[model samples]
Target chain A: MKRIAGKKLVFFLLFSLLAAFPQIVFAFPDEGRFVFDEAGLLTEAEKEQLEYMAQELGAERETEFLILTANDTEELDLSEYIGKFYDAQYGTVATNPAGTNAAILALDMENREVEVAVFYKAEEYLNAARRGYIIEQITPYLSEGDFYGAFSIYLQSVYEFMGTEPGESPETDPLLPDPVMIGQEEPSESIFFQWWFHVIVSLIVAGVAVALMAHHSGGRVTVHSATYLNQSTSRILNRSDNFIRKTVTKRKKPQNNSGGGGFGGGSIIGSGGGITKGGHSFSSTRGKF
Target chain B: MVIHYKCQNCGDDMVFDSNTGMLSCHSCGRRDRIEDLPEEFITARFTEDEAKEYHCQNCGAVLITEKSTAATTCSFCGAGVVLADRLSGDLAPKKVIPFTISKDEAVKAFQKWCRNGLLTPKGFMTGDRIKSITGMYVPFWLYDLNSRVQARAVCTKVRTYERGDYIYTETHYYDVFRDINLDYVKVPVDASKKMNDELMDKLEPFPYDRLKEFKTPYLAGFLAEKYDYTDDELTERAKGKIANYIESYLSSTFAGYHSVSYQQKSIHTNKTNSQYVLLPVWMLNYDYQGKQYLFAMNGQTGKIVGKPPLSSKKIAAWFAGIASGTFFILTVISQLAGGGF
Candidate 1:
């Protein structure tokens, strides 16, 4: 009877172990090469800084994150080139297939574009706010042709940003250090997070349907094409446009810490991204340095 | 009288082929030029004051297509005949834009419209589905309205500038007035009660220069209708069209203002004229899934318009496709474009 109780307890413990942490199901992704500074633009000191940051982040996150800098892309579309380079350098594993847990930031000095490619969960985790915040910080340096300084700051920010949770929730885990951000952009004040975005999508789709429903059943609205009317016979009596009241809307402009801000708290503004090959997707906040 | 041209080479029937816009013999493929149409047509009233039957002189076969059909081919003998009594007097068309689009072309247009985006049911464009094709001469009354428009508007201009940490917007308001006199020429409304007003409106701006004098040859081998609505009745609809046109015209003059609101407006007509006429249309009727689909194309300009039957199945599929796409994409865009939350 005692042995039976012992076996039941063991089974129960094993089941709980699987259930408690279902998401940590697989082994950590293999750490591939993390830096491809082919541009040779980075000095020895700058290269060392990137190498250390890349190695540390790779060890901590188990994501094959890379920081590549090249003088000019060889006639390849910058975004496409970044995707191909990411696939070749790390040759993503099937386990972390879309690099969902991985990311790569490629900076091109000659053509002047910054690309951050994220795979799999990294897209959902890194989020747009973080991407925009990071880009705002590094733009000023790149515009001034400071490649080493730009990359040096970039490496540090990525290390710090990866620690921050997705969605930038107010509650932070006590164990992990909060992110240190540069160019601290202000978060949105409105609780209407994606309202406009939702409205535009709804409008386009509904417009097509509403338009189809409106006249599809057969009716006609006389258009404003009165130019067909005889213009010479009609004379103007009186016409004028009078001024009316003006409305003032105040948008909470983000606090621009372009001077020097680290990733503590800031919302990314005007960041855009899209999907790449092999079904791998990426999100980025970028500025020209 | 309806006058149909015949093929001299063969005893078979001939028709005014719309594809070639000429009188072509259907049996022998011979084409003939119609030179006597203008002189043969007379605007005098019919002495009989009743509809008349026409018999082919060549084969002694009675020619009948539709009650309003002025000209037709003998089904038995394949000879063309024109009903002299039907188009004798007031029944004669004052002007005509002959059928420029052929039957095959109109059928092809219907097929293309049906298959666009798979909006209709499967096999809706099957050739066997077309029930009938009729070349119709639809009657209309053209109105020329000359009017002076008076309008008063309150307009606004807004300017914005940033100061320190705040943005300021200044709006200036003014009262404006405008008086414009305009002449509208040839706004037409269908005068035939048989024609659907909505479908007729889609066929517009027929080149008036092509309108020849009252002619008999133009009505050959086609269905036609005489105007049923008098000038007094059609004037009302034409006036409404003119008023709407004038209102929009007056409203358009107030450009460059931030905003404009109407105060008062008046349109005074100086002159109005109405003329009875006929326009050509190619019509195809299709009955699909127990519902009728009517397709009409302008005979002059080939501007085609029709209401396609909505496929419930296709609509459901489209909604599913668009909804899923919008849902996934909008979510991703909102996160990437807006705040993290």
Candidate 2:
């Protein structure tokens, strides 16, 4: 008994330990990687830091810039080049120069407008920006040869930026509407009239229905059988049962002098006990024939 | 020799009444002189082996002879004064928690439970529909065990660095150890074959301090029975409960691990003692659409828990409303987008 009990205890403990394995295994968030755009929107301090860190970490840099003129819209081969740049930044193209860190800067010649987009690494950039520092801190240091110092400064800057109190950023408003009320106007006359009319019509219909029901019901005995009869009549009319009966009656005719005569007297007489009554039955049968 | 008392001119069997403290005789109106028995006769103790068993005359159910003396009525039939069967075993209960909450309280608790479940169907709470709420002292084996769990896992540390054009990944591994001491209390293993084990477990953690000596007087208004499962079976279940907790605690403590391979893992549990006690529960059975649904409420705490029947028509209507509303909203949005009003 003792040995058996020992085995049972061991089995139970093993079962419990196995059940809690999944919860313990996966608990950490994924690592962070950042992408930077051109036009120097990021602070110089951030760019220098990122550059030094990139060199120290042996990270590759890929950049592509394009200028487009709205006047020359016919021969615009910008899509092929943009697609290539996108492939280099996001696609699994090893030899492509614009790998991972590629930022596309599109210059519209006609409008004199510029649009910069960093591919694949926007989350990293946002994380850095959230720390109150920009890419400019790391980029310049990467241009210089002190890779170790640059990387250290970049990491410290990111940590410091992350440690600082977060303030409202422009990125928070992309899809969300402003909280403040923009404009106010009086209710439209048509919508108001529509609602009022519906309410008035519903009330009038209810009132008329109640009045008619009351007027018809006063001083009259309400036999439940009468309501059933009304329901049956409505059902018959809706189903066209009367029309079917009329058609069937018009097609059939009596053949003999007997009141119930059709195919034969013997056959009809057996089934037509009520129709073949005494006295005026023969006269009515003759009239029918 | 026949013991009889004469009432003036007539003779009849006469027994002493403890409450009235007088010997009364029928047939002829007369009171006989009462004789008091020694204190030893009034107070006697019977061990598990010595206790006698009595069979219920009405249902043929057997009960211990000791229990029969206190409970004049049969536990099975609620019928009066049945002779007890012969006691044969050495496993008689040493203590029992008498019913504190009465039958009326149980019924009220059941009705309150019904009222609280607002979405429950109508006609369920009607007084006539309640067949019977029999109070039964269900048999339970409480096991206490001290557990020691040893576990190991491979911890991971991820280091990411870019090498020229590509990011290189490196991960380090480590072994984790955990030594835990657990004192498991009152792991109840239900003895009834008919009762659901899962449901019983869910209705657990009853305070054991309220337990009192087994007295048949407590069985007067409530229903109760001894456990069918032996101490061995219950001990096994208690060990299982302890193991579950230990594993959960270990897994939580060893977070950020890639893979956990437990080696030399063992749990040692020692049974300190065991007790048989009675806990109160209000049970309700509802029949809907030719099917029975069972609900139970903890009598002492008044915590109600049960599954209710779902209406197919209401579910269909809800689904139809959702689909229609979604389509209407989407259509309106698309029309506005297309500038078609």
Candidate 3:
């Protein structure tokens, strides 16, 4: 009975050790886990909450939503660091026949750099333009020190982007609030409402009014030629209108250079998605918070 | 030389009454047809001395008069006296337009005109500072003029239209020529040096149809002036008065052209005849802010012309009100168009 017990204990110990091995060895990103706040930017509770939400959303949409932060990466470039991190965790489509679909939001706290990188099937949905829109939306939040809110929005955006068709925009998501359109100038107030415009117009009107009053201070001449002219004897003795020449002038019509509206297709980074020297393919938009 | 029309009924001094168009006695209310008066009475007594000082017929007071004054009242007796010597022979007027507006009516019209001055000073608007009002017959030269106008010009009619991709402008050029003959009669030029030419010109259309042959009785009750300048001396001014009329008449013949550039234009105006005439005017002298303002009214047609003192404060307030109102309207319009806030 003692020897049987010993064997069972050993089997149980080995089972426990095997289960804990992945956590000990691979500390960056765990499968089925989304939030990785290496820079200590988020509270433990925030991470846990975001992780659960991302996990559920990722499963439903069939795309991995990631949030990553690092205090410093030494000499490693931000895009390079995220690319390497992605490559180590999940290989690209060429290497892994089954492929990985993921959208990664990585922040470098020390460098003040933020990037949205897409991998595998995510590249089809979150093209550089859509990624650019997500960045623009989250930047204000990040700048305002709303890390948790920014991350939550980023996860929601990625999930919504994946649910739509490859060529479609996530802006059409019914659950999302209306966004300020990207690359469009903000609508300005009308000139008629401007202070200077009113001043100038008023000055002109007042000047003309005053001038007319001053001119008519002396009465106008009431007599016209017809007042004294005798119509019976006065007549047009000779009148002639002879045609001389005709002239025609033409000007070419101006051309219209405005393109159609909506999201621009194809790749947006460097004319196409960038490829690392290590062969990790991604479409990304990067900026300072 | 100074003669008074004595009433045949009451022996009181008679004056020409514009309302009755007859010689009237103010004391007895007697009216007499001027035509029924004897020829000797109408011609009056003419003296050849051309005296600078004369005695009033009723008062025998030396009448104070200017060199150009043909008729005036006696300062001592308040009698209406006419200097018959000035109205005789070469100094006589051929026609006269009698004063239809009485003194009371003239003063009332002046007050009403003052009330209508929007920018005039507050004190000036009441018209209570009137110093004097005088009925005077100013001398003028009535001209019968003929204008012969010959003009040549290059004119064009321009039209613009649009096609699929281009804008086209078509211009049709024309050579226009006009020869016009125009006649203007009784264009009066003020011949008195004391009257302002511009002020006299403004009080026009003097009811020339009411003109009557001049008689000494017409000048009995009012101050009158013999022409300071002769008809020959004022002929150029009469021509100048009709120059604008001739030019406008020539332009009327070229009405259809869009633009005209005159190549050659000549206006030849000649005087067919002229006559010395007397036109009635009411002159009001007002004193305000130590400045004297002269206002003139046409006696026949009751037209008033003068410049009243303007109030700067009122003008400024008016400007501000108009500006703010216009601004508010413009803002509302832009808001309705979905532009301004």
Pick by TM-score: which candidate is best? 3
How high is the CA lDDT of each candidate model?
Answer: 0.63, 0.41, 0.77
Error of 2 at A102 (Å): 34
Instruction: Return the TM-score for each candidate structure.
Output: 0.58, 0.41, 0.67
Model 3, residue A214: C-alpha shift (Å): 4.0
Between the candidate structures 1 and 2, which one is better when assessed by lDDT?
A: 1
TM-score values for chain B across all models:
0.82, 0.63, 0.93
Ten-residue stretch with the least lDDT total in model 3 chain B? B332-341
Q: Evaluate every candidate with DockQ and list the scores.
A: 0.19, 0.01, 0.31
- Model 1, B1-341: lDDT tens per residue? 34555567985556666666566776678876544334644554665445456666666666665665555556776555666565556555556667777777877766665665355557664535888888877877777777777777778778878777766777777788888878888787887777888788877767777675555556566667766767677777777777777777776787777788878877777436766676888887878877777877788776666776666777777666775677677766645544332
lDDT of 2 by residue, A105-142 (tens): 23223332222233333223323232112223332443
- TM-score of the first chain alone, every candidate: 0.50, 0.20, 0.57
Off by over 4 Å in 3: A1-195, A255-289, B38-49, B337-341
lDDT of 3 by residue, A30-108 (tens): 4436877889987665666567667877989888888889998767887788877777677754676565778889898
Chain A accuracy of model 2 expressed as TM-score: 0.20
| Docking quality band of candidate 1, CAPRI definitions | incorrect
For this target, which candidate reaches the highest lDDT against the unseen true structure? 3
Tens digit of per-residue lDDT, candidate 1, span A1-289: 2432354356446434533543433332333256677877655544554565567656686565677777768887667777667556545445445354666777877767776666666676556555555565567776787765565555555555566565435224221223321111235333333546555665579558745753553323433456357655565655445444555654445566433223433322245676555445566655455
